[model samples]
Target: MNKMIALMLAASASALLAAAPAYAQDASYKSLTDKATADYKQAKVACDAHSGNAKKVCVEEAKVARAKAESDAVAQYRNTPRELGKARKDVANAEYDMAKAKCGDRTGTDKTTCMNDAKAAKTAALADANTGARAGTNVAQNPPATMKENCDAMDATAKAACMTRNAASSTKVAVEDSVITTKIKADLVKDNDLKALDVHVETVNGVVMLSGFVPSQAQVKKAADLARGVEGVTDVKNGLKVK
Candidate 1:
């Protein structure tokens, strides 16, 4: 009778063990379903709260969030992981769209500036994600290093020239900064009486080339010195001869 009781107890324990996984799986499915429902509700709320272009963006984000939540539910219900990564990528794309919408209108220089700022922010985020994916490993953020590895890298002089070109392109956008031009004129006219000499200031590549004639050497030097003192002026060429 003790032997039979022991056998019955063993069978009961085995049956409980066999049932545990299915119970846990059902619980997981319920949790995921709850979470998905919550996410869908939140997204709908967000969609209702926005308007205009922002409304469009909000709706897109909401859709992505809902999709991701649903995908998670499916994965949990089916005990599968295949579509989870794709859902994550869709969520990332949604985030990117939201970021772009935050940057506002891109019609002119403002748009270009906004896009550049957004690009920088995206690059930083990508770098952070890459680092996290690597589990605390460090990665270089420089693109030039990758270029050098891929191609026959230019010599130091050529590299310097390339840097100069890139800088020139950046500076070209700021060429419309009127403060620098105003300051250049103010310093040129300050202290020294410019009433007698017709002076004009022309800037090329940050080099101030003075081409007006002044009455005396003192006046010429004064003008050149003033031009040189202006911020952003690289060099002042004293092309003015004493009249």
Candidate 2:
């Protein structure tokens, strides 16, 4: 009888152990679902408040949020033997239909173009949804700005490349601004204090490449240092000659 009781207790402990993970999974699923639902509701409300092209864009954004929510719910359901996958696909289809309805009144090339644009937007939205499901939602909304900041923080050549890839307009402005600032600094050096000194500032790929002549090593270092401090200069290539 003692042996029988021991076996029953062991069986109960094993069952509880098995159930623990299932319980944990359920809790996790619930949390994800609640957050996703809240995001979708917020998006819907925002979309409904706009009009015209802005409204269209807002709706597109909301669809992306909804897609993400549905995808998360479906993924959680897949582990529990539910029909949530089918429901998620249905939600995706419905989103497509709504997009089409929103864009239907557009006329001429605008109509066809609008439809194509809507399709592309929906595709991108789905991609974003997938990314959010894996990495979280905030990353999707702020990627460009975050990438630009990271690029700006890099050293010289790499920073130039990063800015080129991530922020073209800002990079262009930075390069031009560096060139102008370099010219100003070069003009400030006392010409009589230096001889046979020529300052050349060339910008390429958003990096300042300084080439020319200076009277002394001090002037050379000064020119390069000034170039480095200019906004948008990824690097300062010092190729100055000291007489």
| Each model's Cα RMSD | 24.2, 22.1
How high is the lDDT of residue 52 in model 2?
A: 74
The C-alpha stretches of model 1 lying farther than 4 A from their native spots are 1-34, 45-50, 60-91, 104-106, 134-243
Cand. 2 Cα-lDDT: 0.55
Please provide, for model 2 over 16-77, each residue's C-alpha lDDT reduced to its tens digit, 9 standing for 90 to 100: 99999889877887777788778867877877777777677566556645654554454443
Q: Candidate 1 residues 1-243, lDDT tens each?
A: 999999999999999999999898888877876786687677778677778778775665565555555544543344222333344334444545544665564468866765565455445434433433343211121112322322238788777877776555544423522344457667665664764454544443355645433567888888887877777676775555443
Error of 2 at 26 (Å): 1.8
Question: Which residue pairs in candidate 2 have backbone atoms (N, alpha carbon, C) closer than 3 angstroms, thus clashing?
Answer: 156-234
Predictions in order: lDDT: 0.55, 0.55
- Estimate the TM-score for candidate 1: 0.34
Off by over 4 Å in 2: 52-60, 76-88, 101-105, 116-243
